[model samples]
Target: MRKALPVLLLSTALLAGCAVGPDYRAPALDLPEQWPEHVLLSAEARADWQQWWRQFEDPHLDALVARAVDDNLELRLQLARIQEARARLGLARAEQLPSVSAQAEAARERTPGAASPLGQSSTDNLFSLAGVLDYELDLWGRLAREREASEALLEQSLFAHDAVRLNVIADVVATYFDLRSAQRQLRITEATAASREETFRLEQLRFDVGESDELALRQAQSELESTLAQLPSQRERVRVLEGALGLLVGMTPAELMAELDYGDTDLEAIALPDGVPAVLPSELLARRPDIRSAEAGLIAANAGIGVAEASRLPRFNLGGLLGSAAGDAGDLFTSAAGTWGLSATVMGPLFDFGRSASRIETAEALAEQAEVQYRATVAQAFNEVRNALVTYEASGERVEAIRRQVTAFERTLELAEVRYREGFVGFIELLDAQRALLAAELALSEAMRDRLTATATLFKALGGGWQVEG
Candidate 1:
């Protein structure tokens, strides 16, 4: 036994030396060094992006984001998945260690008088106390590969949670902006309706005095009704957006409706950061959580190939039992009653209709699929960043253009009103000017909303914050 122990130790040391299967190497990406039209933002601006919602400088928005992070159901579900993965990792690690078990036994037997040569009955009792140790030698590194794959899966789950968090923050900010835009449009439409009503009344008075024709009065009434028609639809849209934002913060729609519908908060007061820092395309790929998750999945799959390969080779195990047994319970611990034994097992596949080879093939195919998926994830991340940048840049220009148009239309409305009152122009001309001004105002509001949303989307594409905890 002593000689066998030394040989066993030597074999264990040698078997522990190398794990079978391909080691993970991060795949190379063909990427550009810099983003197109990348803006060099100030360090202060870049820092603000770490918690991008804080850049808006709205206390309410900050509160909402905090609530969403804490209470959101989908995020909680991901956290639970991470816990499950962590538990699986623990199980995998445990497989590498030996298992020990305690055992106890008692037996009572009687010899019949007929079977006894002396014509006497005899009774005997037995007791035992023992322990068994069972351990796999891990000769082919199957356990090691399984542990490695489990670790990679845990990391993948963590990255997936982070990706979901990033999307949630972005969605909340964008949805809030949409709600504000809708509210502003609703206000603008209501005011236009009031102004049109006064214009209609004035035209009716003028017509009663024979100073205006029926056509003019009818045109004024039509404009007022059209402005009024927009209010209910706009208000309904605002309510729907509120319900959505409420759900994101883990509140029921009915519970959140009152708080959102009755607020007098001005959307214009929501201040956003200017000139987001430009990141290199290569750097962007490394920071994105979805891409990182995909890479981890590939690593897990690669380890899976090793595990499958190892399964085809011989398996080694060592088992032993140490115990004491005696007819009298008190003698169970005595040296005279002591017993011990050891065994070694070597197991390998003889033939299984190519099952082992088929497993290797399956593992290889999965690894290949994971690699392609990782590449596809990287490509998708790049495309999203490019599209966001383009939209942000274009949306800014659109806002500027709409601003100028608003100014021009406002001035034209004023001139038309004066000309109509002075009898220098017909009411049709004034009505046309009013419609143009209203459209421009609404367009300007929409453009501003788009600009803010585009910036949020870009921040999301850039992976927002990197301080995610696992």
Candidate 2:
């Protein structure tokens, strides 16, 4: 019976391949076919959204994005998480295989002849060596289900890491634009301040010559000081935004400043795409990383249900030991000195009232939660895309309107300056015109920034940068 046990266990292992509990299937979603009608891109152009930043046609932006990809701390952290998940997957896979160990022992002992029933004293030495094997037969496929769940978790980690990469790219791009916008605004304020100082000097000279009154001179001086005060704040904003961009790219403030070449930085020179491509709402399920991560979680949870169900059934463990034992070392391995044994262990929950039932219930509940979360993620993804589309469209219109307004303000300032020089209008009219022009210029810069940021947001919503395989 002992000799035949190994063969019987092997045959049982071959027959016990079925896993208990439910198999995994993706939950159904009532997805939309198309996005909001106002969005501009044709379905055929969706592929072009990949590498959307390249459309900006700026070398400096390209360099910054590459640096962020290589060194951003958040991205590195996600990569480490991928490694952790991969190690866990390896551990789960190892459980499916047999475990083997080498065991050895040696001893010397003396026995009284009376104790040995020999009526004489005797001494003996014993030595033994054996190789032992232990392996769970996986009768209900518990180990297989565990391995399946682990693989799903690994996939989830990978998708999450990709999501982080996409976010990092978007953050770096948006922050770089913010830095440029601040620099542009600062320059406009500085130019306005210098122009106001010149006006104040001319007003002071005219008042001293009795051509202008104290009231007019003081108004000019007030406008000049107000414009000067704005300079310090604008400069400060530029500095702070630069620091923000530096952190996004994992660089220190000093390093960012040195690399920025602030003197040559030209915010107005960077151009944006005229139109962004649109994608079908249904396609978003495969495109968005967060959605994919959620789905992976669901798969793992579904596998967990099988694992829990399998745990309630009986487990079969097969083991064997082979060795030789004799009074002399030379006699070990001889036919008469050989020894071997095999074992089979069958364990089942005989009296656990509700523990297995509770575990199965818990697994089912978690699986349901994963399904609901997946649906919510998809819904939220669509909402963000819709909002981005609307904002992008409105931002473009605002930029165009501000440009026209700036043009009119420029002409008004020119005419007001002429009228003031001819003494046909008071200095108050000139100051008002100058103030309007400065405000319009600043508004135009802000509008442009918004338009660019809206475009990036739309790209992010559409999951522009990464591809998940079907």
Candidate 3:
């Protein structure tokens, strides 16, 4: 009884022993309390890290985004990663659970006459079956900490997958808008070329009748040739853009152009709902995915510190066996043959080549690295939001300016053409006006496309439209 009392007391002490390393506590992030400068932001964008894609009003875009989120290769890979983390958690949990197994064997032995007198003429066979069990006691909470770390990693993977989804959706929208802009430019160039051809004919007639000089004919032809020369390259740009959009949507380039809708009538309207909300930067610590993932990694590293430290202390295990052994199969489990044993052991690393200390140092370094990564992630997020805000606002102003320029240039071209027809001006004057109008038209289409793209970028930066589910 005295011996048993010491063992009991020892067990209690072991269980109460401190976990060797530092406890995990998330470090406080030093972030902005409010926007530092005047930002062109809306009040409607909240800290809902998901659903950033819905800010684009196209139903078609929304549908494509939904499809990609469910099937994108990158997102699927992250999902698989989360599954891996879950498996690791399960293995860690099982560390403290007992393991059971069955064992069986059959054997025969023969002895030579010269070896021993008793075995000189004898041969025997033996068979037995046994049950076995074993378990480890996590007295220092090492296994428990490991399981907790794995669970955190699983959540991190999930959030990472969501980040990928948001990124893909944004790409598709941006590329689709690009394709439309190219299409608009292509059609504009074609129309301008046709107009120049008519002007060339008129100038040729005037030169024949002595109404215009050779220089006028040459300038008119130059404008027509230049406008016509742009057609093939513009067409090529459209094809390239079509292929890009196809890849973004996860389809073949040929297939994308074959069924692409590039007309403004076909393009869906995207309404800018709102801008970044007025929220504390610290609140965003819970919203951003990369930030969350880094935090989880830091937690995992902290847990490893405990795991490594605990290795220096003794670990206890429970071992047991239950079964019967017999020479004859039918005799198994008889009272005389039945047997069972239960035992426990505590083992520790008495000596090592500084492995435990090295592990603790490595874990501390990694946790520190994760902290830096979290800070960097937040900084990058802020940069994106700031850049998106500036671009979106600038695009709105540029579109308006481009439209006005197009209108003024168009009226100028019409007046120059009327003067040339009335014999009050030469072909060069009309050609210059037409060329200016064409550039303005092209510029306007580009500005509109930029506006649409900038809107999508801002929404993505604000984490505007996704609904992430755990």
Segments in model 3 whose C-alpha atoms lie over 4 Å from true places: 1-18, 36-52, 109-125, 252-280, 423-425, 466-470
Q: Of models 1 and 2, which has the larger lDDT?
A: 1
lDDT of each: 0.88, 0.85, 0.74
Residue 84 Cα positional deviation in candidate 3, in Å, after optimal superposition: 2.2
Q: After superposition, how far is residue 202 of candidate 3 from its true place, in Å?
A: 2.3
lDDT score of residue 217 within candidate 1: 92
Candidate 2 lDDT, 129-172, residue by residue in tens: 78899999888889999999999999999999888888988898
C-alpha lDDT of candidate 1 relative to the true structure: 0.88
lDDT of 3 by residue, 1-470 (tens): 65885696586557754555777787765666775553433434444534655555666667766666665667778888989988988888787577899988777877566777664665666677889998777788777777777877787787787677668888878877787777778888888888778878987998899988899888988888988889898888878876665566666545564866534533324555455444345656666666677777778777877877777678877788998877677788789778788777879887878987898788778878877887788789878877887888899899889889988998998899789888888667887788789899888888888888887887677664533334
For model 1 the TM-score comes to: 0.94
**How well does candidate 2 match the true structure in TM-score terms?**
0.92
Residue 69, model 1: lDDT of 94
Please identify model 1 stretches exceeding 4 Å from their true place. Answer: 42-45, 109-123, 253-263, 466-470
Candidate closer to the true structure by lDDT (higher is better), 2 or 3: 2
For model 2 the local lDDT of residue 322 reads 92
Lowest lDDT 10-residue stretch of candidate 1: 39-48
